[model samples]
Target: MRDQEPAPFDAERRLSTREAAELLGVKPETVYAYVSRGQLTSRRVSGGRGSTFDAGEVEALARRNRRDGSGGSGGGNAGGELSVRTRLTLIESDRYFFRGVDAVDLATRHTYEEVAEWLWTGRMVPGITFTAPPGSVSVARRAVEALPEHTAPADLLRVATVAAATADPLRFDLSEDAVLGTARTLIPTLVAALPPRGHDRRDEGPLAHRLWPRLSMRKDPDEASLRALDAALALLVDHDLAASTLAVRVAASARAHPYAAVSAGLGVIEGPLHGAASGLAHRLLQDVLEQGDAAPVIADELRAGRRVPGLGHRLYPGEDPRARALFALLERIPRAESALLAARDIVETTARHAPLHANVDLALAVLTVSCGMAPTAGETIFAVARTAGWIAHALEEYGERPLRMRPSGLYAGPRPPQPLPE
Candidate 1:
């Protein structure tokens, strides 16, 4: 696929406070307020003290504030859906790109670590290795072990994140290199700490290999399965600004440490509408495997007044590219044939019955069941893969003005009566 041409950057376009206010439908005071809040950028006039706002920056801010109802604008949407600006990933033409590089290409061609570095820094660094301190891993493992017997994988991951953060003295550094370096070590540490597959070596091979044992119950995973798993992880590395990614950015905007920002992301990831959707989809796919037909199961779901899991996405009108890419990889694996067939049938049925399409969650469900992984395996993949993304977003947020995500509130309750103390 051809890359979309990016608009050229222009810094020469300048606007006076009056011009900016006129464009934004506000007074000069509001424009200056935006500048003071770091929502817009302004520079001093040549050899003069007066400020000149960047017209391009002002316009972009105006558009966002207008949409989100934040920039001296009236109350925002009732749903509070926010419009965020990001350079991490782009979803266009039913496909997503990491910093302009097609994700599908990267998934098949690169490893998770390589794509992660590309997301964090526009350039990929060669021979980059991710390893955490033994002490940190040990602490994280103990924390994981302490969880209840029925604890979910995501819950364990949350506890482990806190434990790892407590052990890392350098986590306080918010610099790009420092935060990214922490991510490098943190990812490996998290993987190493999970319980390994019975037959696989705990300390060998790539990140995907190391993670396979922890997620799947099957023994002796093949090379093809591992490769597909790697692709899935790469594809999930980032996708525009997901809810969890936005949470990470919000935490980072407050100058939180990388670990703190990641913790914030993990909090949102456990929600049913976010990462947990994959687990729910896994259960739905299990029904498909048992019944061997998608039509009945889909019909039953609709009859029961339940929305089918992993069937549609808001961003991709026709089909999710990530789902399409991963499903192709799954079809090639001999052990995954049955599960892949089940997933395909559901996709076809959904398309035929409704205007819905398969999403990455459905693809992940097929992969999990086919590999004999735990029901929560899909969410595990999501959380681990998205750690790379969350940290990358944290890095981006750190470079911006601190606390920039804070939005003004508009009260809606009944007005108070006259003061009683008067």
Candidate 2:
């Protein structure tokens, strides 16, 4: 037979959650988490209280978990699933902690830079501000400017990171102090490199304020909006061992410089499954607003065999904690009221079919849509905020033994000793 696309995984066979979870060697909660994250889908039979999983999907996920025994397969393995432990962040039920502290509390009470410093060093640096060197800014901005004008926000940040790495002679230093310095400067440089909206604005105040002009053209943004942006950054600073973070750890394990480690992460996040999810949610909300009803918009999406984005998450079976926290803050913004209502409409409308809860992407969509930002703005915010997390993971990986993330591939192809093709 000619080479063909792998068939879409469907329920040729269905297994109860217990069977599926046992097949994957995980607890029932983990199976639910897998379902929530889109790693597997849960199907409920008529007159049944519990949901069953497609046997094919369950086996595929099992293969993924076993391949090199890492959470994100084919990237590299730090350890088996739940074995990539770190003191950086922990996700429990629907809540997450950073260094043993409630992340939502920290983000709401402190600035993004403060929470980031805490994540990096476990110390609170009150009123810390990251200022990129003029030389680095010049180099990064020039490199970013050279890209095609329609270049994506994440791609722009990646190019800027490479250029900034070139500007710093000590990029390969790998010492804690040097990496911390690079992190402080590199993050600001990433933000500054983007061509500013309205006019070229000088860096000032918190990192969120500096990032605002790059994502939004509105001048003199309000205090509340800036807080929302800052809170979003802090909340998104790190999620333990996400695919991009794993890519970063793998890079750092290989002794790639911090810039390069973050670059590796950026490369992984440009995919629709990760960082671009927020953008998808943004466009979804926009569609709902334009149509004046979420049912029809979501119906169109479902009819076309598309998922309603920003609806579910892997770690949170209930509403995402970040989404809950962001929604609370968003409720205070008068302008966000309409978008928030629309988001609620979307969730309620979709719940008529699937019981998925709102995720951080939906909350981010509300923020971007209400703030007069572009569809790409949510992903931009995510990229800038997540750079801190990539660096944090990089720092953690640097403390480990060198080249620890080696993958053991399971060859499914024809045996290598087979004769060469005629």
Candidate 3:
């Protein structure tokens, strides 16, 4: 009667709202609801008597609804699944503790290695040496060799990790403890294998002993400077999930290897807004010393309504814990009189002039420069120490799903279209 109706091809045919709902296991009314809610797109057909939808669009909507936990059998959705939220440990809080010990207390009382052990192994061991499997040593050696000559230990670390991952066929297995052990082992080893300096002296011990030779300027180690460096590293270990840590977690969520994940963290730290703050701090301190008084410099800066570098923080409302700890340590060290006076003057003037307090960066800059470390080394030393935190955050991210961190925003721009030259 209707010119012999053509045979229906199930594979290529568009789906009607009713058919789409049936395929999605939902009622036609639900499909209309989706359209009304702008969750699904539909096309008007036959003078708007009915609507047609692409089969692919229907499938995609079904997948999204399922992911959002809004769709499935019995009118249930996967979107309702409980997602685990990460607990952020900030530096300012009294409740923030590591390995059952307060971080502020640990930074004051422990060496850098001790703090590293605490973070890596979740124990407050007096000393710990991270050990890699016998098979991994050759890979580590090869990685060390492949790095460019004169590379800093920290830079070599970035190269070594990529090499190690490329060499290891079994690197992708997701064992939490195993990966952490590897990180603990690799970090100390990388520190030891950095490009050797002629003036550096070797000493007896594990991590520090191995690192001592690479960082020394004479056959005998500078005990005072080394002690200062140790305290500095311990203090810089972690500072909540700042921007750089967030970047590390994001990369880890993509199932990136530990090295790649840390590399992501390093990239973020390289920016001026984050880890480079210490470098700025170093320069600011140099200016104060060169100008011969901290009050005038800080006072003029405050009067101009410009924020001084190495002061103020988004987290610490009153003061930086690391700053207080490091400053206290610096006070007891011998022959630090000029630097100590400058720091005291700066602190008093800043307190009198502005609400901002000295952060860890300022204190660290004074300690490092006063100990004769090169200006650039301030940031490098920070990276070497903060690696522990980056690895910890990365490990935490690995346990979570590969949920893309796509923050939504309004799409305001030029309006959609008008005939140009009609």
Which candidate has the highest lDDT of all? 2
Candidate 1 segments whose C-alpha is farther than 4 A from its true place: 1-81, 197-201, 418-422
Whole-model lDDT values for every prediction: 0.83, 0.89, 0.67
The alpha-carbon lDDT assigned to residue 177 of candidate 1 equals: 74
Instruction: TM-score each candidate.
Output: 0.83, 0.82, 0.70
Task: Highest TM-score: give the candidate number.
Answer: 1
- For residues 1-422, what per-residue lDDT tens digits would candidate 2 score against the true structure? 98999977555779998888666765577788787788889988789789988888888887877774744322324634535658899999789999999999999999999999999999999999999999999999999999998899989999999999999999999999999999999999998898887794768778999989888888888899999999999999999889999899989989999999999999988888899999999999999999889988998888999989999998888999999999999998999998999999999998988889999999999999999898889889998999999999899889875775764467799877889789
Cα lDDT tens digits for candidate 3, 143-167: 7777667554446666656665665
Give the TM-score (vs. native) of candidate 2. 0.82
Residue 315, candidate 3: C-alpha displacement in angstroms? 0.6
Q: Better model by TM-score, 2 or 3?
A: 2
C-alpha lDDT of residue 57 in model 1? 84
CA shift at 235, candidate 2, in angstroms?
A: 0.5
Worst 10 residues of 1 by lDDT: 70-79
Give the candidate order by descending lDDT: 2, 1, 3
Cα lDDT tens digits for candidate 1, 336-378: 8888888878888888758888899999998998898887888
Residue 362's lDDT within candidate 3 is: 84
